[model samples]
Target: MTPSAEILAFMGRLGHDFARPEFLVRALTHGSIASATRPDNQRLEFLGDRVLGLVMAEALFHADTQASEGQLAPRYNALVKGETCAALARQIGLGEVLKLGRSEMLSGGRRKEALLADGMEAVIAAVYLDAGFETARRVVLNLWRDRLDTIEDDPRDPKTALQEWAQANGMKPPAYEQTGRGGPDHAPVFHITVRLDNGETAAAQGSGTKRSIEQAAARTLLERLEGRE
Candidate 1:
């Protein structure tokens, strides 16, 4: 069968004319719907993850001549994390093309961060296989252009920073608790609280996921303590 118009349009946005379009189809296939004839994107996701890491590592190494390994590590993590990949997938309308089973579709799998991130990585691997490493690198670098340009010098996650602070002060790491949840199952809001060993606490809400909500709470707590938020 020929590629659908929507898939072709997605390719236009992706900026690669696939030599083997089957790869793109496989890349968009989710595990929830996989079958003997139609394999899922899991393997592609794994390859794409490594591909993304290598490209980002090389880019960071060249982008900042003065940055130490410690400084570059956080920046690399910030760029290549699943959340960021999912955001990029959304930007390119990847979720719209994801093939999922009925259950996953009902559960809003298309909009899931993990699924989107995995799909993004799979697509990267598809590009690599369709053409070559340089082509994949080009796509990754182009897709990550804005993020690469704007990444902070020290881009550690707030949760990681908070834990470091706690450990340095002879305190246990902060604890995160889900205080409440609201909204529909497809799009839920989570309330999380992060409490330090000293009993200092911060609470925040996020519309993404439990992990994101917890991170938001940690960020809020860290900002408050440091007078940055």
Candidate 2:
């Protein structure tokens, strides 16, 4: 079911109000759905990307007075990045509202991280356009406030960090290979493998917006290696 009024009311408690219900509808629409039958979400996705930037900027500035652009940039990226957005989407049960084409639905597109992330971004943008900046910022912070509070500096992508760890150990650099991917064009998976030069291989699975699956794959490999020792 499209997110019902109760669901929206619950979302409102998170600080999001839809001035344009149509935009909200578009944000939840996937391209796979027939254009005539379902409102396409791509446009809102585009707008949402920008809205996310503004909202995040406001959030960083509003929440922390000491943060400079350098520090704020990474934090903002972590919050608004595709993987982060997907995680937030799932937390709010956004997946339950998406409308997909028969093919996409059959392919389990409703639960895709990519789709959810994009839709969430679109939704953020839509909210900004419908209402104003402060409201949108509130919406973002309400959903992501906890994550923001728990923020840490990862410094490097997990793959890069993993490779550095392997190389310093006199171990050959780790190799990564894609195993599989599935989901809508906007959101796809890259199942990956991380291997050490020692002929040891480890596998892991994760879902997200960017190469998050790779991060999971790398973390998995690291844990398995640690476990073996």
Candidate 3:
């Protein structure tokens, strides 16, 4: 899709406008692709991670007047988790539009949750810097309403969540296929294929975001895929 149309659709879903179209493009650029394509989004990704944390923490802390410092931690974790970000990316059709390196593309980086999740955060950071704080808040909060909707007021380990779901369904705990790795020798994205006893499978991309979170998504996707079996 044309960048203009893509940005418009993203903005429509996000309920905000780009203060600078350039930031949006830069945010969309991935390191894998940017080495050849142009500017990289990794720097933007770093900025967005902090911006999202601050904004989400602010919203969680202020939205509920009675929440203790302890109560807000879990809520923040759930909201900023990689799965949440990946869901947001899929919502905006980011997967289909990402410009990835040939190796990353061949290895499924375009559909990798790690990449999508990081890209979304980078986009948020870019929006905030390009526009302003409130605009970024509007965009992030609007899409993350579901997270706010189910604020348990505490943190729950997603790995635990997956185990609970499995046990509830009388199924064995999930198993992960450690497929391979990507990125530089020092930093690598771990590829895992989650499978269940019910003959279903789904892929997960795990890395520095949190190994447990990626495992949870893999487990969740495995169960989701199981329903179709």
Judging by lDDT against the true structure, name the best candidate: 1
Q: Against the correct fold, how does model 3 do in TM-score?
A: 0.68
Candidate 3, superposed: residue stretches over 4 Å from native: 1-3, 158-229
The residue pairs that clash in candidate 2, if any, are none
> After TM-score superposition, what is the CA distance of residue 33 in candidate 3 from its true location, in Å?
1.7
Instruction: Identify the superior model by lDDT, candidate 1 or candidate 2.
Output: 1
Q: What is the lDDT of residue 199 in candidate 2?
A: 81
**What TM-score does candidate 1 reach?**
0.97
Per-residue lDDT tens digits of candidate 2, residues 1-229?
3567855864564466565576677777788874776768888888888877786677677787987777777777777777788888888877877778889877667677788888788778778778887777778777877887787755345676678879888987788778777765545555777788888776655445336766887877776766777
State the lDDT at 191 in candidate 2: 70
Give the Å error, residue 65, model 3.
Answer: 1.8
The lDDT of each candidate is 0.93, 0.74, 0.76
Question: Candidate 2, residue 124: CA error in Å?
Answer: 0.6
- For model 2, give the 10-residue run with minimal summed lDDT: 202-211
TM-score for each predicted model, relative to the true structure: 0.97, 0.74, 0.68
Write one digit per residue (lDDT tens) for candidate 1, span 99-122.
999999998898999999999999
RMSD of each: 1.4, 4.9, 8.2
- TM accuracy, model 2: 0.74
List where candidate 1 sits over 4 angstroms from the true fold: none
